[model samples]
Target chain A: MNAIDHPLVTAYLDAVARETAELPAERRAELLADLREHVEASDARDDDQVREVLTGLGEPRTVAASALSEETPAGHIHPAPVAPGRAKLTVILLGCSGPLLLASSVVGTIALIAGLALLWGAPRWETRHKVIGTATAVAVPVLVFVGALLGAASRIGPIELLLLLAFSLGVPAVGATVLLRAVRR
Target chain B: MNEAGGRVPSQLRKGLLEYCVLALLRDEPKYGVELVAELSAVSVMTTSQGTIYPLLSRLRREGLVDTELRDSPSGPPRRYYTLTAVGLASLTEFARAWPLFRDAVDHFLTDPQGDPA
Candidate 1:
């Protein structure tokens, strides 16, 4: 009934321990101890039950992978690369949000929010680009509103108003687009 | 088979099996074999009973479960796993969230229209 008496059980435990060699020593010890206890206590007198027990435990590699996943981040378990198309779409949306702001305020606001979310969520963009995109998102609108207010107070021409809107929105929009291109992976 | 054969069930079991172990220890401390037997009896919850050892090791590392060695009546000294206060709190939290999550999945699967009603 003891694991020491059963060569198969000892071999199985040894295999599991070897597979998990890279794990922390304390954890590896615990795992081996648990397996050894389970095998020794099992009432499997026949070779069939022993085989079943081993199979139920699965291959050593599979067990090791499962244990590794527990230790690492879930993202490490599955490294899903972002598609180039998605990255391109993010760039396009981020650039368009500026011009969209001029067309219709409500639609532009929705587009701007969506673009910012895409920019922030995209794994392809570096932190710097994301920050620039966010800063541009906040700054462009405030500058435009202030410019429009000042132009109105001075009784500026319609041409001046249009020019102010273009300048205020255009500068950051262009800058952000360039920065995004520069920092993209 | 899909690209990852049997991966769906494996992934689901991976996420839920630790909680199942915590739930098993809710009433009393159990030795590793007893826990494996209970889980294997459920069948769907586990594919390989031996894999539970690594999971138990994780629970111990996470401070959710504690183990103690005791003299057994028939064989070698047995290690019994008991739920810690942190483990009990985690199980309670899972109990609260499981129903809402199950019902949401059920609704999504049953209602193709994605209607809230």
Candidate 2:
């Protein structure tokens, strides 16, 4: 049946579709079919009556929320919870170490190449993997630029940077593993 | 409305909602709007699409009811809800237990000293 002919049902489906865009297409079609059946059975004699009925069904978001709450599938990703202390630490670290890591890598690579070139005393030192290595070599400097911007915004210092590095990598790798294991039981 | 003594608070009647809907749909498939009107006639607990839609979804998931979509002559497509075999069994079970539960509650409230005697 054409949904456009029945505006009430169409509207309902449209709302559902908008809310469930992330859902598989087949599953979404099934939901629409179910809702269409509901409209057909109702004694809404006219379009106005049907619209009124749908209006009472609450907003699409609420409908989606209720549906989601009732039937979430296994292995769905829940948003990671960021505690106040940890969030603050993350912001500080991302800001400071991000830039430092980027800058040091770029400067270190350039220094190494310049030292080699001096030893060879050649006007040009071209390696077979120079293009790939150059690309890789620039990665840290870019990171440093982005990290410096973040750090400046967060007002993080060198000392905070070190602490952030320790926490950011250490917490997720070691602390999280231990904490998750404990919670699983 | 006044068959009993006073207005029945919705909270007290909430327990019977699923039973009522299931019973109403047992005879014929009814859509959202019609179901609301049917339920509103018996009790003050008015049914809205918001309330009924979720209940219908849950009932379908639980295998109590099934739905079908059909074209309407003048308006949007209609969804018809029919009681499944499981739904029929559930309704029968509810009918059997409802009276006993109702009576127990009635007696407790009416008994002066909380004694059924």
Candidate 3:
């Protein structure tokens, strides 16, 4: 029917497709065809009118909501309504408290190790391990910040936050292990 | 005396949506737009294409009706909805029960003192 010739109709269809690509192809085609018919039937014959109709249909998210199955898909669970808000709050809290927590814990651990080593007249290995562990512990947050920076710049998905959390916590624990090993020897 | 009666009886026409839709589609396949238009014409069932489309999709998902895309001469492709065998069986069940249900309610509202049994 040469339906795609009309620029406005074509644009609207493209928008619908972009918003609804996750849907089954058959369902997506059905919705697009119905919208196409509506646009064609309306007497208002310009881009502005077409846009008005699409706007009245509401946001692409709302339109997509109508087609989504009730069942949650695997891997990409639709978060509960409060989940995004909660996630944002948690991220902010973590961002603020994370470095302080790491720094304090690292300093405390190093102080304790140094105190013990000094009391025992320990070898250079003890001093070196304490310094390295303290530095590594402090570096963990910086590594996390760098990872977060990359995530923000690249527009990575939420999974990146999990990666950041793991790095932020894992590095310090590894440092603590090195110190404990030196103390044991 | 009032020329017209009081409010229309709710019992006479209430909750017939599923029955009405199935009945309409029993004869032949119809698409979203056509079904909405027909239902709106018959009763005070005013609905938008958006509303009808979802209901149709749900009906299809529930195995009540089957849908297929066909090229439309006038515009883009059309989604034609045909009653499935399960849908027809359900329709028959609804048809048999609807009249009895309607009459039972009608008797209570229209003839309060006529039958106590």
Candidate 4:
């Protein structure tokens, strides 16, 4: 190893790189570069000074966490670890809206809207997932409302309608699955 | 570390931390090690000095600061960060507001029970 590549410093930096795998590649590179510059500049005369420099740098995980939070957009103000509970609740609410709409439109609308609110608010999933989730979850109600207004549903049998509801449920179900899988936790 | 994965770093006024960083560059350009050292010297800021890199990176991205790579007399070339026109304006604005903001916080802290009216 080069003289500046102190064993302890290398280990710390390696850990930080591993923890920051989720950061945008450009950001991760910039961060690592900045850290490397600092380590090189410290130029500790001995192991003890090296230790003090590393201690001042703190744990790798903390450095990664702080780095991650800084990248989160201005309004996000994310709390600590992502909540699995929130992700689960969001899935259930959005995924069930189609089935519930068949039983009661008012209840179904409430669930879909609430689910959408949570979906948009949660940071676990990206904006793309949120848009897809919203689209799929709302598709059933929208189709139903539009079909009714246009008299398209008048020609369909009960079994066909049930199939339509199931189809609607299926799309949002897939959407919810994608979101659950995407949870940053 | 106290609670397995808990982050227990002291919460200094978050905005103040970045502004303090910007303030450091107002007079003259400073390198990464120099800036980090200045912050670490203050116990009240109380954080792992490494975390300040992200803030520095952000300050650069936001056009508040600009960096120049210069050859150091010692080892590797050092990246020196200098405040920009925008940065100076922002620091001045914060300096103006901070006294009032500080006094308000002090007032509440000192007179917690006396001003229930």
Indicate which candidate wins on lDDT: 4
User: Which model is ahead, 2 or 3, in terms of lDDT?
Assistant: 3
Model 4 regions lying over 4 Å from their true place: A1-3, A76-185, B1-9, B113-117
Name the runs in model 1 displaced over 4 angstroms. Answer: A1-4, A73-185, B1-5
Instruction: Give per-residue CA lDDT, model 4, range A1-185, as digits (tens).
Output: 43257887788888999999988789999888888878777777677887888887878998898898888847965554446788788899999998898789899989999999999987667788888999889888888888899998669989887789678779889988888777753
Residue-by-residue lDDT tens digits, candidate 2, A122-150: 21223322332333333444544666777
Question: What TM-score quantifies how close candidate 4 is to the native fold?
Answer: 0.60
- Local accuracy of candidate 3 as per-residue lDDT tens digits, A7-111: 766775686678777776787876776666655555455667766655544455545655563223235553233233332332233333334444585654454
Q: Rank the candidates by lDDT, best first.
A: 4, 1, 3, 2
User: TM-scores of all models?
Assistant: 0.59, 0.44, 0.43, 0.60
RMSD of each: 14.5, 16.0, 17.2, 10.2
Relative to the unseen true structure, what is the C-alpha lDDT of residue A46 in candidate 2, on a scale of 0 to 100? 72
Compare the candidates by TM-score and give the number of the best one. 4
Tell me how far the alpha carbon of residue B18 in candidate 3 is from the true structure, in angstroms, after superposition. 2.6
Model 1 residue A148 CA deviation (Å) reads 66
Report the lDDT tens digits of candidate 3 across residue range B1-117. 122112242222224555677788999998766776676675344322343454566577768899888888765677788999999998999888877877888889888889743
Which prediction has more favorable DockQ, 1 or 4? Answer: 4
- The sequence of per-residue lDDT tens digits that candidate 1 reaches over residues B1-117 is 433238788878878999999999999999989999999888688777767887887798789999999899987789899999999999999999999999888888999588774
lDDT agreement of model 3 with the native: 0.58
Candidate 4: residue B32 Cα off by (Å): 1.0
